[model samples]
Target: MASYSIGDVADKCGINPVTLRAWQRRYGLLKPLRSEGGHRQFDEADIQRIEEIQRWIKSGISVSKVKAILDTNQGAVDKGWITQQEELITILRCVRPDDLRFKIVEYSQQFDAATLIDHVYIPVRQRLGFEQNTVRNICGLLDGALIEYVANQLILSRKRKGKPALLISWDDPDRTRLWLEAWRLSTQGWHIDLLAEPVELPRPEFFPGHHIFVWAGKLITSRQKEQLEYWHEQGYSIFHHNPDLTS
Candidate 1:
């Protein structure tokens, strides 16, 4: 009957403590015991349940639907991405900036960055791409709110100690995606110094012993590939992130 604190469970499950609280308060996915001080206390069974929840989420199911799936012990019946996309589209169509930003923050608390990016953000953007000019204006609003949200997340992440890394994009037209990727890295225990604009590759000696993450929204040219290889040879830990290739 050993019990663990919320931080302990978050570390063990590779989940944020904020996300764990969201699961309990918003989604009812967990019901941990409260100590005399009103602190959350999780038992071993709770840990196992968290792993199960992670499995469902990794399969592209939204946290909002996880409770029902677990209760029924059934496979995902409806598409989570579609549901999330529809909700977001409705919010955007309302043309209310505050509501959109509020939902973005709420989503960040509920779901991990990767899940939010892949399931909700990317799919919504793609769906709106085929729409008319007025709808496309709404898409631009979403982008602005997302950029602001991720930037604020990055600032908060800096208060924690993590390995120092530089995040930059070379030839990515969308700065919002770059910021989103930077925030994603921050969640992975990286203290990110993000350069949102495309810049020439600096000398490895400038950031000695630092991880350099390069993001390209499109296919990299031959010269860009050579530059990356050269940086690798120069003892810089180079990681190329191409959303086009991965997504």
Candidate 2:
């Protein structure tokens, strides 16, 4: 019988409040009760329904098609991420910077960062990796577009009111993945400050009271582990990202 605000639901479901509002206003996906103040109030059922929608999205079902599937209570139809990935690949191969940026922004609006990264961006990168000779050139183009998109998103996220957090990458070769990870966190309502460069373990005191998210694509060395443990003991919240977690 408990009621929750939109922000609470967004935090619990790992969705942006803007996306939740869009779901109601545009897609008619959610119908929450209105309080005396005319504010949206959600119950436990709404949270469960949001999770169901997330599962469908993670399974590669487009948002526009989700309502029909949910109403029918049918299992997910395998639309897959091929179409989206193909469109992005074409834009990248053509070296169309404007189209590429537009496509990336379009996808970000439709899908959350995690869904877009896992289903579209990462797959496109992998597909390009198999190219005969122009893999580097094409992937570089894609990375540039994505970096620009994420940078803008980061700036926008900073303008919003949210918990302050610092994201750092340690010895991770794939810089694009780090940015994508930060973008994913930012979409979840965190004001992210990302250290894009690979650096040694930083002193927690430098950013007191800020949650620290560490990304190490490789295995954690003992020294690094000790430093993280030290930070934990000093009352710092640390989120360590490794291959197992990211993969």
Candidate 3:
């Protein structure tokens, strides 16, 4: 669903612009679509092929041969791992903090944050309906384990990456969402300043230093939404999970 320019492709593929152009002209290595201005335009598929070409080149394959391999359209496939949602729910219901943190760390490292949330955490939370008597206890224990292990891991990851940005959660900020955002940013190599609890808008002077500000929460008041828009209108490079604002 994304289109990329030659420069974007060059940066992401780690190929110089000159070399990428040469690959197109010399070996017909790319078949990008044309823009309205007749400039070369690439899609996500092109990016994937470019990554594959890079891998082959690193493995002692020649550039000339790279095109042919791509033409054949052979590539490695991703086999996604399955999660044990019910088992996790059972453990959380039993309030096993030690065992819970172990599973959280293992899965967080093995899979990305989004996958862990969607496949593991979200499913378990949904299944732990109001009818379940242990739901309250499970919720409390789960939150504690996540904050101690998983959230801290994301914090460390962001610290190591060092391209600082801010994450400010609004009223009653969802820690799970914060963890997911922090981990997502960490994976993309950003130094994150996560305000895990609800906080007022950071002072304007602080804005200059951050790459961007992400306002995250499940619910937002009109006042909160307006404040976010005010920051956005001020050219603060702000992003929010609120659908209405983005849309």
Candidate 4:
């Protein structure tokens, strides 16, 4: 049910914009819907095709061979592509963590916290790949239930001098992971702040001292490692988890 621009599709699929257009023009890999202004508009179908192409590329399959495969299996490819896209979008929209948690608590006789996480939270995150859309959904759910849970807890902690909640995020090529974490932490009662872009180890003064800084995927740059160390030194607790490591 979601329609995305070519840029949105490229960001989701982790492909360069120019390369995406090139594939369209030369390889006929994707035929996107055109806007009134002649802009390339893509939907779930185009996103799937790009993902398949990315898989082939990662596996060392030649672009030409990949194209031939798509050509020969056009019907099947289209069906599978659109199906996967629709499922992802659906899972992304539903299976929210906050709602699942409340349902668990409200129906404790029927469901438990662990059951909720396993059945609802975990699967949606896994499919959505932790992006901004997923994050927004998770946050909206948390804003109602989890935030209240944390506020109640905070009232009990009124006497303790707690550190300010810190939010640290690195600019990722694909922001799904970042978005998921932001919403997940917010659900846990942490204040949510974002760095719109990646930063150095010693972040700017605007970043709170007591916040939880999250890092994602492969730490491919020295700056990333430095940022991690800097936050650790600043007394902010780090919660680091790699999906690939667990999965």
Give lDDT tens digits, candidate 3, residues 1-247: 7899999988887789898888889988888998999988999988877776776565345788777655443321123222366567778767788888788877776777656654566435544532356685477677667667655766577546467677666544456656555656665666676777766555545667466555544345677678768987887766665322332
TM-score per prediction, in order, is: 0.62, 0.62, 0.54, 0.32
Please state the error at residue 124 of candidate 3 in Å: 2.2
Question: Candidate 2 regions off by >4 Å?
Answer: 1-77, 218-226, 242-247
Poorest 10 consecutive residues by lDDT, candidate 4: 113-122
Which ranking of candidates, highest TM-score first? 1, 2, 3, 4
Q: Considering summed lDDT, which 10 consecutive residues are worst modelled in model 2?
A: 72-81
Worst 10 residues of 1 by lDDT: 72-81
Error of 4 at 112 (Å): 11
Provide the global lDDT of candidate 4 against the true structure: 0.54
Cα lDDT of model 1 by residue, 1-247, tens digit: 8999999999998999999999999999999999999999999989978987886675446788779767654232154556767888998998889989888888888888977886678657756754788887789989999988888888889899888889877766677778878877888888888776776554556677778888765356678789888877767787787542443
Please count the clashing residue pairs in each candidate, in the order shown. Answer: 0, 0, 0, 8
Residue 241, candidate 2: Cα error in Å is 4.0
Ranking by lDDT: 2, 1, 3, 4
Winning model by lDDT: 2
Q: Root-mean-square deviation of each candidate, in angstroms? A: 15.9, 15.9, 16.0, 12.2
lDDT of 2 by residue, 1-247 (tens): 9999999999998999999999999999999999999999999999978887886676446788779757644331145566888898888778898999888888878877777886688757756764667754689899888988899989999888888888888766678888988888887778988887877666567777778888774356678788888878878888686432543
Q: Rate the local accuracy (lDDT) of all candidates.
A: 0.79, 0.79, 0.65, 0.54
